[model samples]
Target: MHDSTQSRRTARNSLLIMVCTLLSRLLGIIKARVLGSVFGATAIADVINFTFNIPNNFRKLFAEGAVNAALIPAFSSLLGRNEKHRCVRLFALLCTFQSLLLIPLVLVSYFYGDGLIAFLSDFDANQVRLGGRLLPFFMVYLATISLASIFNGVLQAHENFLHAYLSPLLFSICVIFGVWFLSDRYGAMSMAYSVLGGGLLQGSYSYLMVRRYEYRFKPMLRPQNAPFKEVLVAWALVSLGMGMQIITQMVSFLFASHLSEGSVTAFTNSTIFYQTPYGIFFNAISAVSLPLMSRAAASNNAPLLRTYTRNSLLSLLALLLPSSIILFFLSRESVSVVLQTGNYTLADATLTALVLRPYLVFMVFSAWYALMLRLGYSANRHALMTRIVFLQNLLDIALMWVFLKLGLDIVSLPLANGIAYTLGLFILFFLLRDLFPLTKEARFFKGLLRIVLANLPVLAFCIFYKNLGLQWHESGSSFANLAYLMLIGSAALGIMLLSYKIARIPLLSLLRSKKHGGNLQGDNLIHLD
Candidate 1:
């Protein structure tokens, strides 16, 4: 009975997380549409993407990866032990430390922004100058991201993921609003500046929610506490993990520099398209899984941990694999429709699609690797995960060079990433098996087989439907094209759901949740006492 209740709670919490993430991604899609409509992937759009990458890279390094990885697990441990005040103090110290660290970095990036752009982008003098002019404004955006990240970690620590999960909508809104209203007035730079303002707003909104939940921030350092020390260790591990991505970015930039004149822009645009699906589904699932995984580990519940991990991974695979197949088939057309407007030429769209084809293949593996790493973190094996991350980066670098030397050219960049992630997934699978041998429930594998079998027909139908839609769009009226697309997409989704039902997978279990049903297993979703 207790286990049933716990599982019920877990399901409810998971549902809530999905709801917020869905809302956030919906806004993100709308935001992308606005950007597409207004700027139409012009050189100006290139400037925005390129310039913002400077600060945004830092945001990922410090805020998204390292800070969250280190902060959440450490805070959870302290909170679990009832060291409440110490946890608060740790937050204050880290906040101060982060502020101090970012100030100098942001200023340096701001002042020498042009030089950095020149060095990294390897673009012509004029492009470098324009990128520099736009980079400083991104400092504000980076700062906003940093603060918001901290608040998000705090929320997750308390198992209050709703606000943190939903806050991204505000960012999407700011960008869409800025482009819609200010694009004509302030031109391209105004859109970038609006992003800056949006960042500030997002940070403030998150902080207010944290305060409302009775969490306060102070400007001080107290690094001597036990929790602080743990955070320091976790930080070291996550820093290593975060460096993998930075290295990948550097490799990508190098390839971008040597490619044709607009190759950099082409790569950036296509990457954004690939990232949309990734951000909407993969990232959201991983984010929700982290805290839940941590809680399961804290309580040493092996069965529940395995169940959650497998379920999350299965969900990722069930969606990502089919999406990847569909995207591969439609890559060129999708790229053209989304980005081939105004100054963005057919050549740019073609190259972007060419690169996207291989790059998106990594999505499934990347999502799986992310979940595995989080599982490692939950198990308090940061040291092992750190080593794995270091090796993964080394492999990525090596693969990138090998691909270049083999004359695979620019397309090799994404291929290298895809290969690296495939390797990472294998290693992760072994580690997971070794770490929780008992939790490798055979039922999970059976369920996976069922899902795969059910998906075969669905994939075939989707491809056929997509082809028909494309043919109609080419010859039919605009309304007819629209109708065809809507019909196909809706049909595909409906078929997938129907397949889940027929296969007897738990896809619809959450929808049928009853008050007395408790959890599907003795799982605790939020784990907030």
Candidate 2:
């Protein structure tokens, strides 16, 4: 009964995140169109994307990803034990430590920002100089959002998710309105200023949310505190993994710089599109999974842990597999409809689509891999997580070097990303197979096989849809391109759901399935049959 209640709660949270993520991503698409229309996928766009992304990468390494990975589990455990006071102290300590570290980072970016930008990007002298001016604003954003994530993690630990998704949505809105209203006046510089404003707003909202929850700021810095030490231990390991990610991102920028003019913009925007579905599906699940998994692992319940792991994987693959397949097949039309307006030309869209197709593989497998890491975090398996992240990053760089040398041009970026993630996924499967109860359930494999079978026809429909759309009109009008997308997308989704129904797969139940709740509620899931 408790598990069932948890399931409903998680469903409501996931539903909230999905709705907000959908809105934010759509606004994000509009932001892309504005940037493309106003700036095109040229040196300016490349510079803006690269410069901003560099600090955002640091934000992942130092702030949100690292903090959430460490803080969420500890927070969940503390809250579960009715130790809210200790949790607040832990939060304050982490914030102090983070401030101490991030202060130096912000200072470096301000003082030596251009040199850092130059090192991270391989742009020409002119582009480098232009990008240097924008780095400070993005770095400030990095600092603000990083700090806000502390409170964001607090909300997630409580399963009160007002701040987690809103920050990015605010960021996107700032970019869209700033570009639309101020582009003619302040030009691209207006976008930079808006980013600074967005970051302030993000920090503000998080602060307000914490206050509303009746949590006050109690700053305590005690390095010898065991909870603080434990989180530091986990955070250090997580930061190592995120550092590798940061390194790979920087290297990719360098690679993009050498590829061609505007290659950085293509690479960056392709990544944004790849994240659209991932944020919708896995982000919400992971949000709920981490807290519950932490509670289970803290109780040392192996069976429950395994169940959560297995079910999360099932939920991910159930929706992700079909979506990825269709999106992979429809990458071109999808890119055109979303980004091919204004300065984002047919040629530009084609370049981005080429990159986005292979990247779809990363989008799928990385979500699976991320769930495993969260499992590791919950179970306090930091060393193993470290090694897995290392292997993934190592393979990515090695494959990227090999692919670029093969002269695959800009497409080599995502191609290597796809291949590395695919390989790392198998390695994870081998290493973590014991944690998955698949062999215990013979029918699991059968269901997965059925899902694979279902995706086949979805694949066929996507291909047929693609060929059919080509006969009507390929480009020239965004409306025609969007209509083409709507037709194919609606059909592909219907086919996927219907196919799952024929196979007796409760797709909606999977969506709402909590860590301990796998059974269905009639009201919670759609009755497909």
Candidate 3:
């Protein structure tokens, strides 16, 4: 009965986060369209991409990735122990300390922004100088979003996901309006200022939500506080692990910057396309399951922890496999319809699509790695996760180096990322064998095989439909191409649903259980044990 209830809660939370994330991603896609139309794939776009990448990468490291990984598990454990007051205190302390820490960092960034931009990007001196002027504005996000992440972590610990996810949409909206209205006058600097504005709004909204949840902010900074100490200990390892991953990405982008003129822009654009579906689906599940898994681990409920871990992985594979296939087969059409407007030319679309195609190959592995890292965190295995991430980064750098040596150019970046993630997924599975074995009754490989097999018809239909003499580029109109692609995609989806139904795959059944309150244990297609 408890298992059933927990499953329902996980589904509910996942649904809430997923819906908001889908909406946000949709808005973000529009934002990307606006960026592509206004900026095109030019040196200005490359400058903006590289400038934004630095602070945004740190935001992930300090705010989203490390802080959440360390804080959420500890917060959840505190809640499990009925230590609400300490949790609140720890929250305030984190906020205060992060604020104090960011002030000096922001100042340093302002002073050294030029050298930092030049070091990270391969742009010429003039462009790098312009990007340096923009870096400080983006650097402000490091403070704003880091504080917001603490509020978000608190909300997630309390299972209040709605506000936490919706707050980011404001960031996207502000950037869109900034680019639309101010880009002509102030150029990319307007967009940089808009990012700062968005971060402020997002952080403020998160702070309000924290207050609404009855956690008053008293601005405490207690270095010796036990809970704070615990968070710091976990945080160091988690940050190191996540920092390695983010650094690997920065290195890849650095390589892209050195490639062709618009290689950085193309790479960034293609990554946004890949991340849309990933954030909407895979990330939503991981976010919801992490706290539950932490609670299970705190109580030493190994069975429940294993169940959550397995279900999350299977769910990821079930969705990611089909999505990847579609993206891989229809990369060009997808990129064209979404981004081909105004300054973005046909060559730009073709280049982005080329980078996107191989990137989709390991989308499932990316999702799996995300979930596994959360699983490791839940079990307080941060040191192990750090080791895995460091090794993964090493592997990624080695692969990218090899590809560059072979003269692969810009495409080598995403290809290297995909290959490294695939290798990392295997490494993580073996590393987490003691906490959550992959060979349990919910056999990971067997279930993955089922998902892939069920997707075969959909893949076949997409191929057959594409060969029917309809070409996106030659279709003469974007609307016409979009209509045809939608038609074919809908049919492919229908075929996938039918295949799942005929095969009694567990994906749909799990979703149905969420709505109907049915027992997933009785769904013979899945092994819960």
- Each candidate structure's count of clashing pairs: 8, 0, 0
Model 3 vs truth, CA RMSD: 4.1
What's model 3's lDDT at 453? 87
Index of the highest-lDDT prediction: 3
**What local lDDT score does residue 72 receive in model 3, on the 0 to 100 scale?**
92
Look at candidate 3 and give me any clashing residue pairs.
none
For model 2, residues 294-364, the per-residue Cα lDDT tens digits are 87778776666766666677667777888788888887777777767666787887788788888786676
What stretches of model 2 exceed 4 Å from their correct place?
32-54, 105-138, 178-193, 212-214, 223-226, 253-269, 340-351, 361-363, 403-412, 441-443, 466-469, 511-529
Give each prediction's root-mean-square deviation over alpha carbons. 4.8, 4.2, 4.1
Instruction: Give the TM-scores of the predictions, in the order they appear.
Output: 0.81, 0.84, 0.85
lDDT of each: 0.72, 0.77, 0.79
Ordering by TM-score: 3, 2, 1
Candidate 1 wrongly placed segments (more than 4 Å): 1-50, 106-137, 178-193, 224-226, 256-270, 329-333, 336-354, 359-362, 403-411, 438-440, 463-482, 508-529
Give a tens-digit lDDT track for model 3, residues 1-529.
6645645665667778878988887887789889988998899998988788778777766788789899999888888778887887888788788878888878977899889877877889989889888888887977898889999999998888888898988989998998899999999888888899999999999999989867866777665544787788889888888777777877988888788887888998898889888888876777877887788789887766776777677778777788888888777778778778767777888899899988788888888887888899998888888888898789889999999999998888888888888888888888888778776644545666777788999889878866775565533238878887787678877888888877667553332222121223334333232
Deviation of model 2 at 85, angstroms: 2.5
